[model samples]
Target chain A: MFFDEFKSWQKELTHYSFEQVSQGDVERALGHERLDFMDFLALLSPAAKLYLEPMAQKAHRLTLQNFGKSILLFTPLYLANFCSNQCVYCSYNIKNKILRRKLSLAEVEVEGKAIAEKGLQHLLLLTGESRQASSPEYIADCTRILRPYFASLGIEVYPLETQEYRELYAAGIDTLTIYQEVYDEDIYASVHLAGPKRIHRYRLEAPERACEAGFSGVTIGALLGLGEWRKEAFFTGLHASYLQKTYPDVEIVVSAPRMRPHAGSYKPQYPITDAELVQILLAYRLFMPRGGITLSTRESAPMRDALLPLGITKLSAGSLTSVGGYAESTETGSAQFEVSDERSVEEVVAMLRSKGYQPVFCDWVNLRDRRGA
Target chain B: MQQVNCELLNDPFEIGGQKLRSRLFTGTGKFSSHELVPQIIEASGTQVVTMALRRLDWRNPQENILNYIPKGITLLPNTSGARTAEEAIRIARLAKAAGCGNWIKIEVIQDQRYLLPDNPETLIAAEQLVKEGFVVLPYMSPDLGTARRLESVGAAAVMPLGAPIGSNRGLQTRELIRILIEEISLPIIVDAGIGRPSEAAEALEMGAAAVLVNTAIATADQPLEMAHAFRLAVEAGRSAYLAGLGARRDQAEASSPLTGFLREE
Candidate 1:
């Protein structure tokens, strides 16, 4: 007999006891002296789009009120590109005959030192799914080796076990970013055809496991164009809310990444407009004012600049989207995706300074120092 | 005529599971050097100091200042910049994780220019934190009504501002503070707007359980001398209040009450 699934989308959607909010609620929350979580939902509603200017103003005021005249800057270094999964939309898919490379320990050290020399403190480690080459042990070893070199070190790689996260924690890995790609299970399963990435449930459970393993922060997001943007947006906020409440100590960051042009032959079926992306970002901020909202290099300079003070708190400047691109950008042959902002680190810092933002080059928190052992 | 047997302040004034003896609370911002900060704070006799949350400066040898303060002084991490309840909640969580003490000075001020306390936001944050088992001492405007409401919500103390924070304008609401003294039974710490020894003395005289003066002492040309002056002023005020101040007469009166008593025979 074929296994009949008892749970369905309808059941899962219905089971969500989220406090539903309307546009009016958002207006009330913004107008009121105190904003609650429900008010966050109201601000993100379709009706709240008309009030974008005011919302942006309120977000700016709050940002200044909380963070003061400062903007934190960090850069992501794509360490390796060796995948086992057939991710249809990704540039680093195993099926894609593009040059695949993995950074050696020395190479990672070289890139890390190069980035660190640029007065960069916060470093994000990126890689594709390659259990053999980029295993948890390898990542942990890299993290341990790179701990003293940077102030804050985070990872964006394949999901691992909770015990694996504990091992990484021991290795001084401070933060983890595991994008669900799409929260819709069917879309996720369809998009990821082979390898451990095919398991939709496991990827969804990775952040939770990482949190359980005592990670300081867990960032959640869905690729904007992969599934129904509205549904994905709602679920992304819901998931962040869940993690925030469940792990109050864990800093929650919500990143909105749309499918940008890449070397992959495939393209997005549903494209997200820049306006819609801004709306989604606004909604996320209105929903969770305290949560960290990040803007990556996937966006154009104008968009990144316009959105910096509005709600986005973190930015990745002069990011390299290919393995070993830091030491030698040309050696990578091709980048995973074309960078919308092509400004160099120095240029970016100068621009940020001219714009009245204190472009920080280093991570503020030392993961190694945080570890008692 | 008398040699005063002055008593140095006590520590750990028994609130919740801890005792906070030194009532003076200081902040790290507006200071020129971190090295001089510990010295100034130590000289101020502040057993508990407040610090705001900031992104870690990973490159600095001493990124976290919490580690630098004298180990005995309790660190009361504050949500000074939060404009709303949610932001305050977020800062509080980060502070707890950073091990800056569970006691949070919940300050949710929306107006950056004025730095006025948003009472509604503060109450909301206090309610949530107190529920979450945090010792909340919210910095509020000196509105007696608000202080009473805050005390009812399990606030360890109601920190009513003598004036807008960092103003150094001194206590501008003496009448209202007198009312607050008459009203709430909780520890009424006069926080902010206290610029000099006289203001500190006045707050103590008004029956404020404690007074938190930062800018007046920290920014003084002679921080140590100013700190000592404030100590004496607080002591004088407390003693005066305890010894029973003479009643003020609205109208001129005879040496004795003319209406109620006959002339001494």
Candidate 2:
């Protein structure tokens, strides 16, 4: 029904004026009139490619204007490395020779404390797809222990059921990030040869499940190097739009984590250039200004820095790809993937400040405490 | 010389039935630390602060975000994470139990990309809460039509986004907000989408009763200083509006005697 409805809507939209939304109007919401869906499509066309630089400038100005010279920084903690899937491109594929490890409850706590001590209030928990090893119970347990330590808790592990997500949200999970890896279902299936991740539809709907389960925020992304970069970016934008329309209350965050150096022979089929990445980010900003665009530590520091003001908002700083990084007591020493920006949290904060962006540590204040009456 | 006092700058402003000595309504997300919040709020001369329920501990009173705020400041708990009427109501109940029942900043955002408030959910939540005797101030799009409906449904005030929340694009919806002010008798607070003091000033100049900002101030290099700037901007904008802006003309009209002065000289 939705597909049919969308098709009709698309047809009807073709008859409407799909004029370009000027960059100035887009950024400042000034003289440029409000755009219909068709106009938005035109604003993101190949013809729109020439206008990317200006769009980025407008996005930068708007970003600074709304968010000021500030950036939200966080770090990811890979709690478990065990995987049930045999993904071709991943370092943690089930058939890979790399050592697999999962942090015990105590180990996770140690890492959590180290992250907090390092001045990070937000943490993203990552785990490979292994229900037996890292069950819903295990993930929720980690969340419960870490809830008091951080202001924001995000999970980028295996996709779970709606009820499972609801439990996690109830356990104080603030954000749920699930990357589709690639939007092409054929490529998605071929890449994840085995395991639960082979199911493209399930992973595709993971974000929706999270939203349905009442998570505050859901992050969607595509691994850029997996398929045609432009096609994937376009699809990623479309996915964001769909989720935004379907679930209005949930915060939508879009991330683009291009394939970096990995152990597998599966090289990048299509490498997205830094400028192209900027174009994608700018397009997103022009199309959806308020959406949170995250830049992982996969990109170079300079690139991340340059992109930060363009359209990116939330970021991961001083992230560790291996389990028990914070504890510094890793039985399995090697990491899943190499980090590009290895700067410490303090250094990242200093950089942001040097760039004139205010680094906000905390802002949540309850009304009951404010008013005695 | 008249003794000019900037301390008078800290004087309170009343909107609806609530009295706010400080005009800033800080957002909870997109910051660096929770430890630095009270200090930043203190420095900003803010008496009213906003928080998202999802970001707080409602079940544990001590762990609740309410316990973290400094004394004498008013806490305006917002339904930030709620996506549906059911969720908003449930969160509102939890908030009430956690001690902020009478006042709620009802934000029912359906679009995560823009964080634009869902009019249907806002109306539903407001209606339900108003009957329950909750003082609901709904965050809405800059649509006067919706504001009137909310007002009719007994909303304390209508807060329309100047732009999308946290986009920092200021007064993007300036025209619509202007219409809201003209059409609605209730206080119109320009909430969200304000990126700088200038944007806040612009809103104030356009006759916004108050402006709610979080990202612009909290994300600044010095949040306290940014807060001060916003305070001044709000005052300036409000003062300018009250002073009466002259009508705009398509062509320039000379302030001085344009025709004869130069020629005669």
Count of clashing residue pairs in every prediction: 14, 16
lDDT of each: 0.76, 0.75
How good is model 2 by TM-score?
A: 0.57
**True contact recovery of candidate 1:** 0.00
* Candidate 2: stretches off by over 4 Å: A1-45, A363-373, B1-265
Q: Write the per-residue lDDT of candidate 1 for residues A1-373, one digit (tens) a residue.
A: 0001213432555654333545555556666433444455456566666666666666666677766656677888776788888988888888888878877788778888888888888888878888887888888767866787788888999999989989888888878998889877788888888888998778877888989999888877998899877667877787787677557678989999988888676777678876667667867776676788888889888778777767777888888787776775335634678789877888878878887888766535753554324
List the DockQ of the predictions in order: 0.01, 0.02
lDDT digits (tens) for residues B1-265 of candidate 1: 9655454222235554676655566666666666767886766677778888877667774656765698877778889778899999999988998777789999999999889889888999998999988999999887866776787789998888888888999988777777677556677888889998898888877678778887887788987787778777877777775554543322222232211111111
Model 2 Cα shift for residue B13 (angstroms): 46
Candidate 2 lDDT, tens digit per residue, B29-140?
5656776677667666666778877653556644545666888776778898889987888888888888764788898877888778899889999999889888888998
Estimate how well candidate 2 is docked, as a DockQ score: 0.02
If you assessed candidate 1 against the hidden native complex, which CAPRI class would it receive? incorrect
Model 2, A1-373: lDDT tens digits are 1234334554554574324444432333211222234334554445555555556566676576566776777789898888899988888888888877888888888888988888778788988788988999999899888877888788999999999988877777768899989877678778889898888777878888888888778889899889876556756776787777566677788998988887778888788766667767876776666677889999878777777777778888888787766766645434778899888788888888898877665433212211111
Instruction: Give the Cα error of residue B27 in candidate 2, in Å.
Output: 44
Q: How does each model score on TM-score?
A: 0.56, 0.57
